[model samples]
Target: MLEALGLSTVNESVYRAMLTHPALDVAGLAAHLDLDPAQVHAALDVLADLALVRLDDTDGTARAVRPQTGLAALLAKVEADIAVRQQQIEAVRAAIADIAVTHEQHEVVLRLEGIDAVRDRLAELARTATTECLSFSPGGAQPADTLHAEAPLNAAALDRGVRIRNVYQDSFRNDPATLAHARRMATLGSESRTVPTLPMRLIIVDRSIALTPIDPREPRLGALELRSPGLVAGLLALFDQVWQQGSPFGEVPGARAGELTPQERALLQLFADGHTDESAARQLGISARSVQRLMNALTERLQASSRFQAGVEASRRGWI
Candidate 1:
């Protein structure tokens, strides 16, 4: 253990022998320890240099200093050495900070590959968001597990007083899971709206950083993170335009007595846009059978003989 304080094993042995037999000379210590006199003399020299042992020249005798004093001095020296190293580490960190900032500024666009990477980056952004968060959920009905995973992040942001504004595809209205998720978020003070179609999936935090899928059709591949001011501004503008056209998730606008409900109007628009029943159902977050039933109801209400006639009658009434 004394070796840790810079004492060699032989030096420690000699010092211990002196403490036990303060009158012993080097030759006596060597005989007691079964070491050569030359070896004992070398150990004595080291102990003397460390101030762990003292020699009386007139008497030619050696004795150990008090262990408390010797060990306390060693500890103080070790602490001083640690303090010097800490100062060096601080200097190095300060020198690297500017370089790190410069590199980050130069790298404006970052491409993150793989679903896990994208999700992790998004989670990090969400966790760090300060003022606000804007998001666009374009696809129809999202999986329940996906919404479940995202709920806590949204909840945490809301808890921090981060204003959250989300735009979801109109089809989400027909999805039970999505509706429940939206309701939960609304209760937590998040604002949400719905549009018939959305351009792409996006997330913007504090208008300073944005994330969008690299390919809207293949979101699982990866996403692009944008930090450039101009690019983020453009994306924010697009979001605002869509946000203006969307209706609040649970709001019901007043209509004339004979006017179509919002769902009916959306159905007519989807049909006029040439979307197939299957596609419409997917986009509306409903089953294909539900689409057929809605179509039948529309034809009956319009007093039309066919689906084409129903579209014509609906358009004539300004329902499309």
Candidate 2:
């Protein structure tokens, strides 16, 4: 413990020995500690510099001071030194803060490599968010474990009154875990919506910074952290366009028999626009099998013998 205050092991041993035998000289201390006289003398020099020992002029001998007095003085000096170093650290941090901002502004876009880096940046952004957090999670049902891991951070942002808006693919409605997560988020003041398709995974914090996958097909490879005003504005505009088209989670408008759900309407619209089944599945964040099943169900419900006939019936029913 005393080593942290600049005392060596030998110095500490010698000091302890002095406390036990207050009248011991350097030679006596060496014999007691099984050390050479030179080593004991070196320890005595350090202890004396630290005011732990003093020379008695009348006897020309070294004496240990009361530990309470000597140790207290040493502690006071250490604390003062620590305070000065802390001030220096704070000064350096303040000096770097502006430089960091300037560097980010100049770079405009930073490539975050590796999953850990991406997650760390996301956490940092969430922790510092003050006004709003907008996210687009495009894909099928989100994993329960992933949602569980993010719950605390999301809840913390909500507690700070940070408005959170999330957009997920319509297929997430079929996922029990995602549905439960959405309900929990809603209780924490987060708003969610679902659309047939989303451009990419994205996060925008307070409209000042944005994060998006560099390549949506290989999202795990890396991500881009964007701060350029123009790029951020463009992303924000795209998000707004999609948000306007999304149906609120768990609150889709009621539909009668033969009436299409929002997701079905979107599928039909994509099909009408000449999107292939595979392309539709990719856009809708579902399997081609699911798309085929939805189409088959639509055909049966419309009493159509073919996809074309189903589309005609759907159009006639204002379901498309």
Candidate 3:
């Protein structure tokens, strides 16, 4: 391998022979190395360029430089070249990182089709998350199949010391099985809270990636996976706000001492806060017709003829 240092076999052989036989002329060096005279001359020319040999102007003879000086200098040059290449590689890597950040923040949102795809993505996110996994599990009691599927994933994240915080609707408190499951998860180092309602089902991991349903009304339609930092940050803030307002998932209260159900109170507040029937139904994860039917029943229960009277009666009863 002196080839790597720009020396051919002929050049290296001539140089080594010349070093050992300083008194040998070109013709004698050729015989020593078993090379033709022209080949020896060509090797001498290359060796001189590599600083492996020097020309004596007085006698026009070529002499070999000491290996320690000549080889060391060539090695130093190789090292310098490597150092430059490393710097170039590092610069390219930095540029790629910047572009990747931009792409993740501005352009990446993947649509996951089918229940299996959604579960697969959730599994991946849970596996990789290192800091936090926050979720809003809306609607009423979770089905047995859902609890079964989610248990292992939640346990894995907790075992890895990743904080898992979940918010469920207050209606879940009325379901014994769901409440028990929530308590069990809490015992395993997960935090669970219940609100009157949730805007949608959402899961955010490490505040860097989020997944939500393509249609809030139909989770069966699958999910939309988001990596955009701005969108994820907004969803993260929403989770924090709702989580702060929720009651811990323990010792389920009886719809506020049997007067108004948690859902009724939330619906009243929604209406008073200027939400339309459709919007209120969306927040409650029900249909608009359901909101209207519920209101009609409320009016009849309060002995009121209209929504205005219902509102007034509800306020008088401290139900709003």
Residues 91-210 of candidate 3: C-alpha lDDT, one tens digit per residue? 979955764676577667777897789988888887888999999988777877788888888898899999999999876765678878888889999998888788888999888989
Give stretches of model 2 more than 4 Å off: 1-105, 253-258, 315-320
The local distance difference test score of each candidate is 0.79, 0.83, 0.81
TM per candidate: 0.60, 0.63, 0.56
Residue 309 CA displacement from its true place in model 2, Å: 2.2
In the range 154-257, model 1's lDDT, one tens digit per residue, is: 99999999999999977787677888999999999999998766778899999999989878878888987888788789999999998998889787433578
Number of colliding residue pairs in model 2: 0
Angstrom error of the Cα, residue 196, model 1: value is 3.0
Q: Each candidate: how many clashes?
A: 0, 0, 0
lDDT order of candidates, top first: 2, 3, 1
lDDT of 1: 0.79
- Worst 10-residue lDDT window for candidate 2 reads 95-104
